[model samples]
Target chain A: MKFFINKENLLFAIQSVQRAVSQKSPLPILTGIKFSCEEDKLVLSATDFEISVRCAVPATVEESGSLVIPARYITEFARRLPDSIIEFEAGPDSTMAVIRYGDSEFNINGYDASEFPSFVIPEEEFSFKLDADLFKEIIKQVTFAVSTEESRPVFTGVFFEIVAGRLTIVATDTFRLALRHTAINEETPELINVIVPGKTLNELARTADPKSIVEVIIGKTHAAFITGEIQIIARLIPGKFPSYRQVIPNQFISEIKIPLKDFLESAERVALLAGENNLLVSLYIRENHVVLNMRSETGWIREEIKSEVNGDKLEISFNVRYLCDVLRSINYEQLVVRFTGPLTPALIIPEDNKDYLSILVPARLSRE
Target chain B: MKFFINKENLLFAIQSVQRAVSQKSPLPILTGIKFSCEEDKLVLSATDFEISVRCAVPATVEESGSLVIPARYITEFARRLPDSIIEFEAGPDSTMAVIRYGDSEFNINGYDASEFPSFVIPEEEFSFKLDADLFKEIIKQVTFAVSTEESRPVFTGVFFEIVAGRLTIVATDTFRLALRHTAINEETPELINVIVPGKTLNELARTADPKSIVEVIIGKTHAAFITGEIQIIARLIPGKFPSYRQVIPNQFISEIKIPLKDFLESAERVALLAGENNLLVSLYIRENHVVLNMRSETGWIREEIKSEVNGDKLEISFNVRYLCDVLRSINYEQLVVRFTGPLTPALIIPEDNKDYLSILVPARLSRE
Candidate 1:
């Protein structure tokens, strides 16, 4: 596009959009960033069929024009350019452009923007305002439990359920489930449910500013998030999300409280002794303390850490990786482990945070 | 055997030796770290046939004994263990050991020390002392030019020449050469030349203390460096190193001085457009400015930067990677570029320093 802007401003805009550029797209144009110039601003966008991102920066537009430049070259070039005014002029042909800064000038090749697909967000009838930090935290806690395999599309997404002035997000790969709920002020006409791909949520969590207010718009098949200077849209994973409410246990035979950091540190070391693939570790609930035991062909490690225990004594074995993930995603000091039985799933929650919870199914201890 | 050692001290000793642990050793004992406890100190060592490293740390030893534990497991376990006095007690048999710290304990399996090879350094008839920082700096400047391919064993190591009161290190892959020399006061019985493997030099550079005096001992089949609390001995690559004195021309047809950072920044951008495999770029050295041009199947980029020229104009092309490496490794503000011809090699040296030099051969330019 024919525009003159600051090097830093252009670089920031390009980086925000280039995150969605596809490295192995079937169509080569999708690997480029479409640049458009209007009267006083320039817009940049990139898409990979599933997720699209766009950002606009203030620039002096000489003439309204558009072009699609290779994202990699443009980003690297702009980043390396000295901090000064950068001039971009679209060439007469569809395959060339000129960039000038100080005494340095480059005639770069580009594709016509006419061949690029439109990334305009359609008008949506339903939308809600949410805190960026809270949304990011919910995504962090739930995204880890989403199934990585694509065979079951529903499990590959984080389930979103909103009703009665509260929002709850759930994700599971059948072995473990993470559920987090937070109170919101938005009024809904009815209960709303949607399945967002884990990839999109992760990107949103990365790009969103902690203190910024994000407006989430849900359309027929697509969802758009409008943050500070960027807009990200992604197509929803089409399928019915699993009902995880029934998977959580309602009663517990024993509940023990342990320091979160201590427990996570011990489990991490114990997992190392559990071999590489099978991360099995046993937890024994005693009257005064709790013990973590891990064994493999290499050796066995037993860690006894002081804890506050109540209710019936029990012993359970689980994949220590799940427990570590839950602990890392939390910012609380103490974690309560609620056990239903040795064979069933256990509920783990932050001692001071009632809105967050995780359920991990115990694995059968193997005899070596 | 039993001993109580601080976790941090034990961790450091294990890490220093683990660098030589062989991942693909034919004998499994070579993959373990041999621990020898006697009197009031513990020694840890590992060897991979080509290189051997050992370090000792002070500890209270109740009984004198030795054991070889898997390097990977012991290092990782000690790193995760809480920072405290850790008690280690060998089982009745060499195959089992118990480690306790705080309330955590681990029963680990290990191999007997009898299977480990001896890494004792023989009495050296000749030795020289050098500053660790100076030695490390010399290695950093010249080692990048070492040939990575094992087909040419001679080029895979850095050529070390000691004569009179000077030490010169040279490395080259034939395309480009990096040579650096420094003055030392160590009295040598006679002039000596040896080739030290690049891997060994790199490890030595990383582990050597910057402020300590390093004692270098040259043996018939190996070279040993003793610094601080660590001793590293590496087998030398046997072969006649190519004479690079003839490659460094004494006279130059033209010499151009340029601001190192400014030149590097512009060249980096031009290199990005040179594509993946061939990073070819041409520098047009005019009377007042230098123009860098890069062309590939994807596109072409041109950048012109100002410079101080003192001779006839010339145009030369080179693989920008070699030039970039020299610039990044140097801390000098001004760089003097000496040119012989468009086809011959060029010399680059720090403007204020005479002990460092690099010669880069020009490449055939590809016309757009």
Candidate 2:
């Protein structure tokens, strides 16, 4: 393909699609980025058979053609090029392309465009639009709880449930769960649910433009996220997601309200004494204060913070990492934590917002 | 021991001495930092058998004693503590210490201070003081050429030669050499030469305070760098450093001056196409311009930058990484490169500075 484009534009387009390039595929062409130059724009596409990304940038086209270039070389070359117009022209065989800027040029070998795998998004059954920032926030709130264990494939993704105009997203790793609720602009005729791989959700969040709107389309086996000039298609995880609603406790024997910053900082300090792998810390819920305690082979730490507590006093232990994750994810001045018993999971929510919550299961205190 | 110190002061003291704690030493006590509370100051010391560091901070000391605490725990605890006066007290047996701040406390287990390795700086044979910023800058300019190959232990250190008031430092891996010279205020009566381990120099640079003066003392078997409230003592490498003066050519047949920005950028871009391990790139010096070329298995790249060439046409090849290192390290607007022949080494010097220079041996061109 023959085209001329600004260096910054080319760099941005490559970055958006580079993550989808296969690292160690048996088919070499799968490791390349397919470049297609049309009348007024150049489109770049890459896929690893699991997720595909496509990005387009405006350019001056001299001829309409296509080629698949090695991702690494093109990326580094584009990053080092001067901030000026870059001229790209393919040879007659279309296997070699020359990139020129000022007096410098790079003759790069590429693969035949016909050999690249075609990326096709299946027909969508439900579609809706959401603000890109809101979508990113929703992903951030839930994806951390997604299970990294591959044995239970269904738990490795974030569950998305849509009923009417409200969208509920949840992720659980059997021990902890994160749930968030938001309202999308579009309403669907019927209830729609899908499980998206957590990795794809993270990539989508990273590439989402805060000022733009994201169109999310869900199909039987695939889902697509289209933003301003980029589109990401991810394969939906096929399996029945566990019912997370049953995991959250509805009643609590003790409820405590504490300043978010004080509680988070205390937990972080007490966690320093926790075992590296177990990360277990005990919390004693009293009438006027909460005490956090952890013991390692070398030492033990105890931290106490003031809190407004009600009901019977209780002591519970948890993997402090989970507590820290939810504590950092929520942006609030204070948090309300509810506990049914020492062994039951605890519910933590922002005091001012009811649409978001996180549940963490308590671990058995080893010292006891 | 009992003392009270501000959280920030304790954190700074821990940071300065933590680097000397051994990660996997045979003596477990070496992995801990020795804290000594005396009169009105708390001193922290740590050693890994090769290097030792000590830092002191002001504190309100009620009792005078010492203990060795694990480095990792103290570092993390200090980082998480509130920004207020922290109370520290040792138990009766001195095997454990309690750190209290606000209503929180940490009981940390530690070793007996008697078991800790004592760090001692021997009587200095010669000493001199240099500006901390200038010393750090000199280290940075020469340390990059230090050999990483453990087989050649002598080359793994930077050679320091002091004659009169002039101090010269040289480091080389046999393929490239970086040399720098500066004059110190204090001159010794006799010539003093020593080879300091590159790793020690790097740590010294990292810990040096820019606004303070660094007093460098050379003893029989050790060297000490003292700046502000921190002191680092390192064992000198025992070996005869090679005479590097012969490696640098006395004269050159071809000298070309080029803008540092253009030359550096072109080399960086061309280096992308060079072999991953060899990093080979060819430079063709013409009458008015220089062309940089590199060929990979997949493709080739060529870049031409204008230059002021006063020598006959010549072609030479070099490992682009060495070129890029000196280019990035030197702060200059233009560089004068002198070449003796296609197979000899080349000299690169900043246009405005004469106290620093780099010698890079050329590689054989594979294509020709």
Candidate 3:
């Protein structure tokens, strides 16, 4: 294969596909990026069995051929090449590939392109285009709560549910759950439910441009996200996700409003004194003031912030890290803490918006 | 003990001393920072047996007392506290310390002050003052060559040799050596040779301001650096250092000048294709052009650049990483590579200065 392309354009395409390359794989071919020059474009594809990324760059195709080269070496070489056009040509016997840029030439050993696994791209059947910025925001607000533990594979992904014109994203790790609601511009369709791995979603969020619209196509076993000239296909986790709506508290006997930044700062301060593995938080409500206390045999910290309380004074304890994560993921100016008795899980939501809610299970406080 | 001080000032002092704190130490007291509050100053000190740092912050001390608090907790707390005046008060029994800032209060369990190790500062000793920026620059340039292997404890640090009117710093890892030369204003009757730990020097570099002047005091067993209100003392490694001067070649048969950035970029590009862990570089010099070839059974990369060569055509091979490090550390625009033969060690120096040189031993090339 022989082709000439801009260094930056080729580098970007290689990097976009490199995210799916696996360092530890049974097949050595999986460690390479397949490069094919056909017609008028150069195509780059990388996969690790579970997910695959393919991107095409405009190029002057001198001859149409294919070869698989080491992903990391090519990526680094392309990145360091001076701003100039890069040329690639297959060597004799197709055992080596030569890359030339400016006065520099890199001859890298190549793997048989026939050994590379082929991934089929799902046809654009039921597709929806959404604003990349808004989609990224929704993912950021809910992906952090996804469970990383692989024991329950279903919980390791975010549950996407679409009914009528509204779309909801929910993630739960048993200790805490995050739910975000949004509206889609597409017409009402049959209810759709799928669990997409949080890691793949995060990569998509990073690669997607905030200003561009991302086209998403869902299939039986995989989902495809097309942004600009890049396309990413991720396999759906096949399992049953827990019903998170049932766990959210529907009633609250006590509620308090506190500034978001103030609460976040105080939580971070108190968390420093807590143990590394687990952090305990004790909340005491008295009159119009709320006292947040965290203590360990190592140290103790107390923060008192004035809040608008509208119920009987109560005291509750929970994991401080869970509360902190929820507060940090939120972009609201003020947050409301709704409690349903001392032992029930508490709900945290933006004071002005009810579209997003975070539920934290309270810890059993020992009698002092 | 009771005192109040600006949060920013206290945080800075705590951060400086915390650099000496080690999480994994046999002595528990080494992990805690000793606080001594007297009259109008609060002193914070931390030591890891090998190195110690102490700094004093201006404060309104109500009474005089001292205690040891966990360094990590205090540093983290101070970093997160709001920008305001912080109040510090020790318990009547002196077993707990209270830190208050705005509406937040932290009560950290304290250790007995008597358990904290005491460090003595040398009086009426040899002292020299130098620009912090220049000292830091010299350290940055040579310290990267320090031996990380613990087999030779003395080689794990940089040797600082001070003569009548000059200061020379040298570091080597057996494979490569870097030397930096700088002039000192004061003349001394006695020559000084001290080997300071690379880790400690790195910490000192981080805390030292580039624009300020730093006072250096060399003692019998320890070296002290004073900058602003902070004093850092490091225990010298006592042993005979390798004769680095004898290893550097005094004469060479061939010398080539090349742009530092171009050489670095080309070396890095070829090195990426070299085998992991073992990076070998082969240089082929012609009448006016130099070609660098590096290949592993796994990959192959070759780059050619034009240069001005002074001797007959020569070929040499060496560890690519060593050359890359030296080229990266050079601050000059251009560098000259001087060598005796293909197997002999090569010297890399700034094109305009001969005082600073990096010597790299050649590596045996594998048969193709």
Candidate 4:
């Protein structure tokens, strides 16, 4: 293979695909990124069994061929090259590749391209296009609530459910749940339910550009997203997601509207005095004020903030970290909090929009 | 104790002293900062046995007393407080401290002030005032070469030697040495030698302001530096530092001058192609040009840069990381490299000044 490309373009393509490359894999070929040169473009691909990334860049190709090179070494070399045109050529023995930029040349050892695994995408699947910015925002809003513990594999992913014209993404780790809903332009009669790993969604969110348009294709066992010159394919987690609708409380005995910034600041302060391991925080709501109390073996802290309270006064306890995560994820000025009882789950929503909701389970109170 | 102070001023003072506090110390008092409230000033002190920092801020004192509060918690609390005057008072039993800023209040459990270790700065045996920027520059130029290994405790510190009107600082780890010298105004009859820990010096360098003068007081066992409202005292590392002057070659058989930026960039590129471990780079100096070579199991990289080489042509090999460190530390336009032989240490100095020098020991050739 022989091709010439700009340094910055080649570096960006390599980095986009490098996220899926595995450093240590049972299959040695997985550590190499397959490079293919065609008539007018060069494509780079890397996969680690669960996810794969492929990127194509415009290039001047003198010969069409394929070669697989070590991912880390080539990436580092390409990144350090001067901002000039880089030329890559495969040797006749197919055991070495030469990279030349400016007056420098790098002879990198290559692995057999035939040993690389072939990844295929289904031709017929549920496909739709969405704004990259919205998709990335949805992932960021819900992915943080996914469970890191692998004991419950289904809970380690975000649940994506689409019905009619509205699409909702939800993630829950039992302690807290984040749900974001948006209306799509496409009309689909089929009900789509799939659990995508939180980690893969996070990577997509980071790589996707904010103002770009992205096309998403979902199949029986895998999902793919195409953004600009990059295509990302991730294996879907095969399991039945729990029914979260039943857990969301429909009615509340008390509701309060508080400034989001003020509440977040007060919670962070009280968290400093919370328990080291449990990080428990107690909320005492009375009339038009809410008091946050935290106690640890070392000390205790109490902070109060004024709010617009309605219904009966009540008290609830929760993990301070869980609440902080929800507050940080929501970019809203005012938030409405609804409480059912002392032990029931509390729901928080943005005052201007009801499409997003955060649910938190109350901590068991310790008798003193 | 009772006092009120500006939140910003108190936060700055607390942050400066908190640098000396470590949470993993065996002595519990080391994790707390002593707060002494006098008639017009509030002094905060924290120590980790080896180093201590104390800073004072002006405050309105209703009563005079002292207490020790947990460092981490207090710092975090003060940083997040509202932008207003903060009021602090000790409880009647002297076991708890109350802090109030704006509408927020934090009550923290306190330790007895008597339990805190006393950091005493005796009448200075040798006192001198120096330009903070110049002192900071000297520290930055040489401190990176200090040994990180704990086997040789003395090598982990920088040797600060003062003779007549010259101040010299040297750091080495056997394989490489970085030396920087400057002229002071005072001419002392007695020579002074002290080894200060690299960690402490780095912290001092960061905290010192570049626009002001810093008063340095050296005692028999400690070195105290007062910059603005902050004072730092660190115990000296008592041991014999190696005589690095003997290792520097006095007579050079070959010399080469190269642009610093070009040399550093080329070295970085060559380093990327070196092996993951045991990276050795070879430099071949000819009559009119220099070539950098690195060959590893994975690949090989060769880069040539034109330079004005004098004397006999020579080839030498050294660890790439060492050369990169020295090249990065020097902020000069051109650097002159001197060498006696292939095995002798190579000296690198600024083309315009003789006050700084970096020496690198050659690596043994592999028998493969």
Predicted structure with the largest lDDT when compared to the true one? 2
For lDDT, candidate 1 versus 2, the one ahead is 2
- TM per model? 0.96, 0.96, 0.95, 0.95
DockQ for candidate 4: 0.66
How high is the TM-score of chain B in model 2? 0.96
Model 3 residue A348 lDDT?
Answer: 92
Candidate 2: residue A140 lDDT (0-100): 90
Those runs of model 4 whose alpha carbons end farther than 4 Å from true positions after fitting are: B273-277
Residue A192 miss distance in model 1 (angstroms): 0.9
lDDT (10s digit) by residue, model 2, range A43-102: 999999888999999999999999999998898888988999999999789999889999
Per-residue lDDT tens digits of candidate 1, residues A196-239? 88999999999888999888887768889999889998888898
Residue A232 Cα positional deviation in candidate 1, in Å, after optimal superposition: 1.1
User: Which residue pairs of candidate 2 clash?
Assistant: none
B281 in model 3: Cα distance from truth in Å?
Answer: 1.2
Candidate 2 DockQ category? medium
TM-score, chain A only, candidate 4, equals 0.95
Error of 2 at A2 (Å): 1.3
